[model samples]
Target chain A: MTTIIVIYGLLAVCLVASLIKSRQKTKKAFLVAGKALLKMGPSLLAIIGIVGLTLGILTPETIEKLVGAEAGFIATVVAAVIGAITLIPSLIAFPLAGSLMRSGATVMTMSVFITTLVMVGVVTAPMEIKALGKKFTLLRNGLGLVAAFAIAGIMGVLL
Target chain B: MIKTLKKFAIIIILSLVFIAMAIWLPDIAKRSSIVAWDYFKEMIIIMPPVFILMGLMEAWVPKDKIQKWLGNRSGIKGMAISFALGTLPTGPLYVAFPMASSLLKSGARVSNMIIFLGSWAALKIPQLIVEIKFLGIEFTSLRFILTIIALVLVGKLMEFLLRRKPDKEYVLPGEGN
Candidate 1:
């Protein structure tokens, strides 16, 4: 993907710059990276497992059924909760939202799904807490969930 | 050994669950492993460079510089920089976490980092293009505006609350290295 390429390119450029400027500092940077990577290894594996479970169980068809079965306020809430829980990649999530919209899912529900999908990240919470601490993770996600609903409500009303 | 096992308890439990599913629910287990393997591949590819970038920032960028650019006094300029950095074509939200952690250690404001994280997750350019393609321009644009507004408010609120009771356990492993 473009993202992977961009990151590799950025890393190559930055690494070269750092090496040319100060090989000692570049070496230190690698040390820091290695240590952090080692520290995060367990959490990363857990995250992978969770992502797999979430996506496998809540495939697009299943998600469609869950969101489409309900309407009005209930559907919107279910959509938001599902969005918050799952960590669907944007590539899959956006297109899924589009199809769901076409298939008679309400605009409010789709908007809620998209907003929560992007803004929240329940599955990534362990890794996030490890890096940023529990308070930061909790507050950011808590606020994000609230904001997602608000944004979805406004979008639903406006569009 | 016990400490290490405890640290890895979650993974151990997950592995057991996978095994259980394989026996009782073979189909779901196969599907789950496939999905997990796919993501594990992606993570393996992406994580090294991301951590390297974070390390490079830590070593090369001076703390005062980060503080001046993204600290409390950074104001609108800080927000702009955070927004621009966030909108870059980074891979995922998890990648941003370590980088944001580095920035926090270097004295960036909580609110600015929130903006950075929020934009990275919600308002990246590539993601917007995809949104427009699938969801239409009108819907994409409206959501964009609303998201931006909501993110700023959320960031400010978090900044205020954190300032009141700063998290004492923000340190990561291998600090003082």
Candidate 2:
């Protein structure tokens, strides 16, 4: 859409400017932004806005229809449990969740799915273990999975 | 210069693949329309502040402080602090990894660092606000409790495993590849 294009365009410009400023050494500029951006306030603000949009778009009715009542509840927990061991980038998870939502997936299911998608990351296990050591990675992810499920279940009950 | 070339090549390839998918898969375009727009907009708005924060962290937080906080000998207190700190609102997982890596290099226990990074993704403050707005307070509170417990347990488990036989081959940041 127009919004997407504009945003990407702006990002491209910023990236290009940064690259040029660093004397065409793309990595230097990109890395600087990449590292510096981690602590930047705008990034947090944008995250807030995105979270708002996601919440606004997701309706409770959408939750009931996608997963069904009983099955949906079960699915929520299952997804969380499974998510702990699986890992994929947010780019994939967001689209997949959106597609599912459009196709009539429940909000609860989507919530659980999204939570697990980032939190559990079983797929990234080997890489994480390698980088941080095996035992620590496993334990952290394991805890994340449980938290994802708990969050989903509690949300389901409250909302 | 070589790194620049490699980066350029990677970027070009990635862009091409993206374009190819966009053209070849019409469904992707249709499906991702609203969500993608929303995500893009969100990213643009938030990126500046996030980058600023990253700069601040780089400028202010010293390597020694991170080490002392999560050092190997710190025990349970260290893990608890790491988890608490990780729960703070932050950026994507990728952003947290480098900081965690730095901690690892500075004498932080691998288990504690892992817990910190894991919590960074799972228990972010901004994410919590979103959950509260959409889901309600009770739900968010319970989730937080559960996530904290899980992170702590995992951290302990990792410690036990590492002690059995530490892997010296694993690369910590700044150790060089």
Candidate 3:
């Protein structure tokens, strides 16, 4: 993907620049990277495993069906909760959301699903904690869940 | 040793659970492993350069510079910079985690990080195009505006709470490193 290419290019440039400027600093950078990667290994494995399980259990069809089958406030909540749980790629999610909306899903339902889908990550919480600490993970996701609903409500009223 | 296992307890348990699932339900296991493998490949391919970048950032970008650029006093400029950097070619929210962590350790503001991660997740350029194509211009635009506002509010609130509570354990014993 373009993202990968850009990152590699950036890395190459930065690495070369760092190397030219100071081999000692560059070595320190790699050491820091190695330490961080080693630190993250377990949590990373945990996240991948969790992602696998979640994707397996909740296929795209299942999400589409579940979101499409419901409506109104309750449907919105279900959609939001499901959205918080799953890590669907954006391409797949947006189209599904659009169709669900066209099929009579409320503006609230789709908006909440979209908001929480991007903001909250229940499945990724463990890894998040490993990286950003416990309070941060809790506060960010907790506030994110609250804000997702708020945004969804306002959007529902306005649009 | 025990502490390390404790650190990895959830993952260990989950892996065991996954193995059991594999034994009892081969089909689901196969499907899940394929999905996991894809993610693993993505992670492996994407991670080295990212961590290296983070390392370079940590090593080179001085603490005061981070503070001046993204710290509390940096104001709207900080927010703009964080959001801009975040919406770049980064792959996922998870990838942003370590970067954000390093930023925090280097003295970046919590509020800016919230903005950074928020925009990265919800408001990237490529993502916006997909959103516009699939969800319509109106829907996408409205969500974009709303998300930006919400991000600022969330960021401010988090910065306040996190700053207010210095006594609280912010990071795990060895995890902050």
How do the residues B96-153 of candidate 3 rate in per-residue lDDT, one tens digit apiece? 9999989988878888999999999999999999999988898889989999999999
* Cα RMSDs, all models: 3.0, 9.8, 2.9
Tens digits of per-residue lDDT for model 1, B1-177: 999998899899999999998999888888999999999999999999999999999999989899889887888999999999999998889999888988988988888888999999999998999999999999999998998899889999997787677778874222222
The alpha-carbon deviation from the true structure for residue A156 of candidate 1, after best TM-score superposition, in angstroms, is 1.3
Error of 1 at A124 (Å): 0.7
- Superposition TM-score, candidate 1 onto the true structure: 0.96
**Docking quality class, candidate 2:** incorrect
* Per-model lDDT: 0.89, 0.55, 0.87
By lDDT, the better pick of 1 and 2 is: 1
Instruction: Tell me the DockQ of each model, to 2 decimals.
Output: 0.84, 0.15, 0.75
Interface RMSD of each: 1.0, 10.2, 1.3
Which regions in candidate 1 have their CA more than 4 angstroms from the true location? B171-177
Error of 1 at B22 (Å): 1.0
List the candidate numbers ranked by lDDT, top first: 1, 3, 2
lDDT tens digits by residue: candidate 3, A1-159 = 998999999999999999999999999999999999998888888788888888888877777777775676778888989889888889888988988888888888999999999999987787788778888889999999999999998888888
Residues forming the 10-long window of minimal summed lDDT in candidate 1 chain A = A66-75
Q: Which prediction has more favorable TM-score, 2 or 3?
A: 3
